[model samples]
Target: MTAHFVQVANAERLAADVMADVMTPPPPVDYLRWAEDNIIFTERESPLPGPYNRDLFFYFDEILRALSPDDPCRIVSVHKSAQLGGTVLANIFCGGSLAMDPGDFLYVHPTENNAQRWSKMKLVPMLKGTPALTKLFPMKARDGSDSVLYKERIDGKGAIQISGANSPASLSQVTMKRQVQDDLSKWEMNNAGDPETQADSRSQAHEFAKILKVSTPLVDPGCRITKSFEDGSQEKLYLPCPQCGHMQTLEWENFLANLDEDKPENSHFVCVDTECGGVIEEHHRPAMFKAAKLLELNGVEVWRSENPKAKRFHRSFHLWSAYSLLQSFERIARAWLNARGDPASEQTFFNDVVGRAYKTLGEAPPWEGLRDRAAKSDHPKGRIPVGFPIVTVGVDCQADRVEFQVVAWGRDYRRAVVDYGVFPGHISTKECWAFLDGLVRQEYANGYGRKIGMDLLAIDGNAWTEDVWGWAKRHLSSKVIMVRGVPSESAPLLARVKKERSRSGKLLSYSKRFYNFATSVLKMGLYRNLVKDDPLSRGHIALPRGLDDEYFRQLTAESRRAKRLKTGFIAYEWVKDPAQANEGLDTHLQAEAAAIKFGVRSMPDSMWDRYEADRERPPAEAQYEIEDLMAPGLPYVPPAPAAAPALPTKKLTKAKVRRGKWMNADG
Candidate 1:
């Protein structure tokens, strides 16, 4: 007892002093200064090795300062391309946390494989190179104590865990003071829930937790990083033009006029400032980077939300490849040269190189091009050309009448519009049914001088469901089918058919059943094909001369718009014009659906090669010859008059005539 303590009457004072010392909090640390002083960059892990140099990447200094424990923001958002050194910045924050503000921290990638690769190629090298970081984790690789997925702090009270957005279970357990998410665009979408919302839950337990998110922009309209960036004080890095001294965000658009696809090496970049008209040179970038400033909006800027009051507790930054020191203007021009003609490459250049979301067209291409491409052939508006081996028909069932388009298909997926016609009359009436019977039964001259009837027909059954069911039951055959459009953007262009019972409750027995498709997918394909089609390329659809501006406008009636989802990703949806009709779009999509039903897209390359070889030979010498088949003759069909008759819109005249433009003159 004497050795332990003297039992004095005033011993309470000593106990009170000890408690106060234990309760006092540690002093605030300067995160950016500490990173520069203590952090190490390995040759294997970083381009600039040894002590972390702040001057090399001045843009990241302010970012780290905001992430410091003393900063008011609990979340940090980073919207960037791969060239912006976002990956290195994330590693620096984690390293700083390990040294100064240690607590449970998390590093997440889009997938487990990505996380593991980053851990080994980046994290391990970083830790091994830095003395302070190395002391935090086990040194020996053989030490079964820690794996690539986890690094335990020597204190054991904290850890740095590596996880993937795809792994729900692994992401759930950790309660962290800091979390860093990289390549968020690549994260798998959770059907049952959102991976991001779930990941955000981990930091819920911490009072001053920090969240950092980074990624290159994807074309997706509802992309996660966009929302993350919007949640903060949206900041853009503004650098003065090397020549003009006029300040602006660097963009590829500034280089477009100087781009020479034919000679990318000689291509140049010019300043957009009209007053300066300066050509940007490779040597001018260093000074530009040095002078670059991360700018916040002044409340009235173009992106209005950049206003002060709009900002939340998070700080967001957008960095573009235009500011990348490693890339040269010539290199950027070269990349555009390789991407110019290809859709996929173009998207990549815009997303990865320029750092922007893929733009989906809300406005159709100028009509003048389509109108110019349309030249009158020997074939009339409704006549099939001799080259098309198969003719398919699609009917759009409107409330008053059925509008239809006929398409001609060849061996190479090359197509021509055989006809566009409007069949007027109530679809439920016998006269309308009679008109339909006449259209499907009519024959058109194939290029080989033989007559060919439609091999497949897909009627729009989405509307007038029961009426369509009755019609399908009457005309249900291998050649005649019904189709419905799916709303999902990701659904396949052509989905597997689901069998349905006839009006008599009889199940359709064949595997080739209803032709249901994703209209959205088909529209995207059509839009891309319209814009990217090179006359020399395959799978091009030619518009006939007789198609007026109204037809083309109707075909392009729907414009695509970017819609943000709750997940912070964007999806493109077709918005119909109040002034125009989508009858042209609907009919064309159905025809495309019919072609898919004919297994045109799925034909084996060998089969296609054989078909191509055979198409070159004379019809007589061809092994696979399309039969000059005509369906059984229908009752007397009348030629459609040039103008609409005086009949009421709702009235049907079956006895007077089965009137339709689709009827063949010879019939």
Candidate 2:
């Protein structure tokens, strides 16, 4: 067995040696000679004016050249960059192959417009150009279709046609030697989900047996064309490293490794793979290159030309050569950088193009200014911080315990979770009552001193709703009320009312007034409006300084794609990451909404009637300030003066209230 294994190894080595000896690079074949002997050609100039006169080969002619005498490569998937003469190259390959072996050939592009464009721009021009080719077959733009051509061969005639990727019916009727998918990624809108993308690709694979996919990369890396190249069968066009014989993909990363940073703009590829470290110039490329129309070499599954050992003129090449012809190195470099590599052409190199976006995301949002201003503003002694105007207490109730916080926003719109409550989760109804009484008592004690009112309290209305509301209705007076309904919508209203800015631009009041004022400020568009001192009402205290700071950072770092709506552009907000926005908005919206519905003012009978009348009027006629009607309580009236002079007032002492032992014991 050992001897047999050694003999097999030796035999394999011998065969490899013989193959390498025979694999010497062939001399460059002249285009003119190859055309006469191998390919039938027709040529024409481009309809659009350009530098070179048109002398092109037809699709069938090239197809004929690429296929074998008896059996041909069934499919060719061409992954391509834009332009670069890929379409023309595909045409040449198909035409040359089909011309030799007369068979059906179907061409597919993303859309009908593109199909027609390819027909006019590439297929027709090539057919009309070459003198010998034009005589062999003739084609003209048909009335309803793009173009049609005939291939009269020794055996039989073949037909070539164009079809759109979206038109499945047209594609199903045809079976051909070659299937060409041009820019499949362009079939769908960016950010769309289409099952047809995969369906069409698989269908085409079955029909043509041989697939050629070609496309430019989409904005998203997960595009259909990209997936096909990565996951589908690959006929990788590999070039040999100058220092090593190993074949590896030649990608933008490989290209950038050769760049000379000192001469930043003038850098090119130099093979520096750990083993090679060889600088490969363009002139030496032809000899170092090898072509193998790979079939199922890796996990990729594709139908190869029936004969696996057959080495034919079936070639696939990634021609970055077209870059120099159509666009500048800078333009291509930027696009290349955007794909995987960093852009090298811009003034700041990486930073100017990519770094700026990074910087923006890294920086804080402008709203941070409002947070700082709100935080820094002075408040009356013992009050919740001046920044905390509208305070919404969120309570999580359990059988034994109730947990809550008085989140206060200052007059400037800054907010904070000022206090919290957590009792036994298994507490009884009496205990729950005690918990409620203690919370209100503590709030009144701290809040009245600061002169900052506790605007609203939102309990978990999802559970224990009846218990919480009933407890509040029985024990709590009009001094404060538990906010009911959806906190997400109500908290903001309360926060808006409590928000206030002083004449000098500093937040002054920590009342329901502040919440109202803040909403008005936001309504006027706080993000865009730059205050003289605050500059962009971001400094408005609607949220806590800490939250506001982070929120601002997120807002500035992110970009919004404002979509056009019937009325105006709806700026769908974006955070750099999904997690941040999800965590923040729930708290912000709920807290803000809670503030809106809390501490609502009562109106007088006459004023109420008038407001009702105005509300009944057409919205156009309802011009009165809605603010006044929404304020708490009936209108004020003055008391009549006494007839005689009043006695001088005297201050009452604590002795009066604690006149007896009972009052002293209670105190």
Candidate 3:
């Protein structure tokens, strides 16, 4: 009951608590034999709750152990679905590494809020609830500090630093041997502008590059995380094939889309070489299946954990299923849109969830046999070859180059990029007009002696449009060339163009059928035909390349606006700035696209007569109706009154009275 006795009793309890927190010995197992055979972690965590499974656990554990001590960093990029225990596995690696080696380890999330949430929801609960795990170290509640340090466990200094992407300064201060990025894509830039460019460059530039990058795919191909995963220079996780026994790493190129209809999908693979036909099928290994199938790739150790039978142990681990479910459909749609700029998937995933509406890529443009046609002008013949109806000249212009497509239409269809000029350094408006005049002279030789129904000659209004417009007005007649207004905001128009791009890439332009020749060429993809071989189709199909960045932006915008109908045609709108949308080029390109839209591809100068004729004819649909009624009250008659009007007719009146014979009697 004395103070001294109370102190002694408190000391005894403290000693007992300390004694309980020690790492216990491993059960009788042949570590030596297991090492020799190299077969380890076999027991399903399902079969024995707490026992070590060498065949399963050792596969990943050995990898962690195999790294060089000085440069001990591994970046594992994982693409997974729900129910894979990759999170727990990641946590296990984090905890185990700190336990085995005394050093700092940081777990970086995309945001501070996420870091706090993970610590509260996963880390704190796991460490506190697991009695067996807690016994390995002294634990304490989190103070204001961002890290939870496990004091001096196994002569290895252990501490876990938790940080969000925003706290780069704090994250940089930590000198850690290992860093784990959990779902880096989710921590994107909330602000405007390019998210990829806004990401923390110092992380990779300093040390995080040497660590691990782990996440699901994102919507943007240009995303920082996606770019990092796609980078070929980095050492990716590769696994030895059970068949050929050769090692291979997973790549997006290896994935076969729509391979599975249910949970636990399989991947189909051939030899990495373009020529080899060797096949490899990747499925759930027994040990891997036993752990939890979060996601699997060749040789990547990305697996999650499952619920333990014991409540304490169950509560101690984070299930991958929970994390996977957190991935919203918005995220998936975003990823789909990112991987390919097609917005058809955006509508399906985000709006209706019906399905991807169009091809992953845009439609194959109508193959305009660039090579052979480039040699000499080729004109498809049917009608008059020389003098025909009015002629409409359709030209398409680009920034550095101007494509003068002279589409002469009648009974005959003649099209040619007659004058191709690649201008330098954004030429002046006078130069542009001069160039246009030159093209006309070179192609038509006296303008072909016909009136040209010119479409819009969109000049660079944003830059040097005034000069170009002035020159154009001075040189060309109002009847010969009319420039249309092109609005600066063309995002909506671009969206429409993107939506109708073919899924199978049929020889077509924006859901419109290409002429039969072009269609036939496209059907026989990437081939050298004996006759009328289409080089553009062949080259485009045979060697797919990323579109130009500016063009890609335009395509993406167009795709977003595209509306797919049950009628098998994609409806879209095209808006180009009349003054400056098509680089510094003239209105020819704009005119051509407009001509195509109007379904007037080729017509001679005489064809301009059609518009005049149309103007003279009465419009087909015009009529109106009116209410029928007579004037109110007796059909509306006016009463007249006598006055001075009789004075003027006095003589006539006297004559009329004499006829009655009364005048003779009065006389």
Candidate 4:
């Protein structure tokens, strides 16, 4: 009876101890402390294979502190250069969170293949090396809990989910408490929507959720990481000059100011402080970083721009290669020197080394400049310029009117705008169709006394597909074809013709063909050509006189811009304001497509010579009459009068004719 009483008392004591442990709160998770105490680097992952040392990259301390569970900052963004320990910081956060604050964690990459590669090459090595993480997530053979995409704790407290931003399925099915997005700027959209936003929504149920975003920026205005950095407290790391003791952010300009190309090793950073005017050498970086830490403790190393939208809970940091321990000033200077002449290489240097977005060449030229230049044009509207052999027309069908642009193509891809106008009537009406029919059949006289007929005509069928297709069927012999604009940036300038199918999924007997051209690609090429000032250069465009300012405004209305579609996909396309009209631009794209269809892009000099020879010959007897081309029940509308008098029909030598300029009367 005494033994049984002792057993009962012991059992009661055990139950009380269990209750006390359950009621006690777990200690706050200090991310930096946990990382330093637990994480171990492997030879495969790091150059220094040992216990994690914060002193090596002391600049990461503030960012690491922001990721702690006790910190109020829920979103921590880092815009950094390539080898600045950004990836290491992410891994540390993942390892620390899994070990100390057991909760569902997520790690996202740009693509599924990237995620798999990172899991095998990066995550596995860290897990195997770190003893504390191994205990939580043991990788046993045939273990159901441990897999390539997921790793769950043995205690059932939490798990780590690996996913790709391009795969919507993996990101949608699970809820995560802490998430890390690597290379956020490279994340592409999936069918489910923007992967970043979708991943963020998974953690909305947790009030104290933590999100860490890290990336090297891409193009300006379109870079996702840049946008996030701007939305947060734009904190820039400032290191003090050893000589002046004045703090300044490490800027590329300051580094370049004193760089010697022949001897890059002699390069030094110039202190921007007006009073000090000190020159700092590379050896002073270590001491400067240490000084910056002391200044940080005194609330001075990091500074934020005045942004009202920035919240205390969101902290962001920006760093470049100059701050990286692995990168030297000489190496960065050499990279800049190598990338001096090439735009592509320069862009890479800016994005990967400088940690800044590169401004692309797709920006629109100043409309005022183009307008002022057009006023000095020697050719007049309604007449083909001298030496141009091929003429094509582009039509834009709208609800109220149909806009058209006539372009003449010459050798070396030089082009001139002959005429542009609008037929003010509903596109579906026969009257509007009649006007277009007459224009297509009309002939324009050139300065060489040659009447040039259009080789091909392209009509935009994106709005009224059926009507445009019907009209195209009637003019099949005249090379009048229907076209649609493709939204993709990588699509070809002009795609192969696609046969139209009926709603019942049957191919039509007529074998009607339509073309789809990449609008983004064509517009990019057009903008690049528009900025060329030399008249003799290839792709130079000549604008005829009498073109109004409104025409130029319409031509320059749309600029390449980054926009988020309804599906949450961010794309760079030609976008214009609601108040601006871009019909002229659309017709110009269509005209270029029509020129491509006429084989002008690949046309040899012999073919151009034949066209030039044909212009000197008499008119063909098989030309279609204006009455035969007019729409039924519509009155005949005469073509506009010539802008200039016809030149004498004197035969001239090919050498005497200016390829893309006004000809002298002596010719």
Best by lDDT: 4
lDDT of 4 by residue, 1-667 (tens): 4554333468888899999989989888887888888777777667877787876788788888888876787899998878788888999999888888888999999888889899888888888878888777678847677889888888989888899998999998788999999999888668877888898898999899999999988766667898888888888877788998887888888888888999999888888988898888878888888888788788774554445356467888888998876788899999898665334446578888999876666677888888888888888877887678799988998666677888999876778998877665667788877887787777887765457778899999777787777777878745787778886542466875555677897875333557788776567567767887787767778988877665787788777777768856566656786666677789998998889888877788899999888884434443446675677987643343345433221121223222211233343
Question: What's the CA RMSD for each of the models?
Answer: 11.7, 23.6, 26.2, 13.1
Displacement of residue 2 (Cα, Å) in model 2 is 94
Candidate 1, residues 522-582, lDDT tens digits: the string is 6755766665445445556666676656567767778778666686645556788775567
Residue-wise C-alpha lDDT for candidate 3, range 1-667, written one tens digit per residue: 6555333458877888777755454233322222323212223323334433444443334333323243223344433332243455555556555544436666777778777888776776555544433655445434433244223343244567777766545455445566667765455433332222223332344442325555543333222344443441222334434344344443333433423323222334454644444554444233233333222423434422222222211111111111222233234334443323113223223211211111222222223332333334232211112322323443333343333333333222222222222332134445555666654443221122222333333222223434444444554332223223332111111111222333586532312211111111111111212122332321111111211222212211211134444433233323333321222123333433334333443334455566435332222342212221343454422211111111000111223222421122123
Most accurate candidate by TM-score: 4
Q: What is the C-alpha lDDT of each candidate?
A: 0.69, 0.41, 0.35, 0.78
Better of 1 and 2 by TM-score: 1
For every model shown, what is its TM-score relative to the native structure? 0.58, 0.38, 0.34, 0.60
What order do candidates take by TM-score, descending? 4, 1, 2, 3
Off by over 4 Å in 4: 1-15, 47-50, 141-143, 297-311, 364-559, 562-571, 574-667
Q: TM-score of predicted model 3? A: 0.34
Off by over 4 Å in 1: 1-28, 34-51, 139-145, 260-274, 291-305, 310-312, 362-526, 531-667
Prediction 4 global C-alpha lDDT: 0.78
Ranking by lDDT: 4, 1, 2, 3
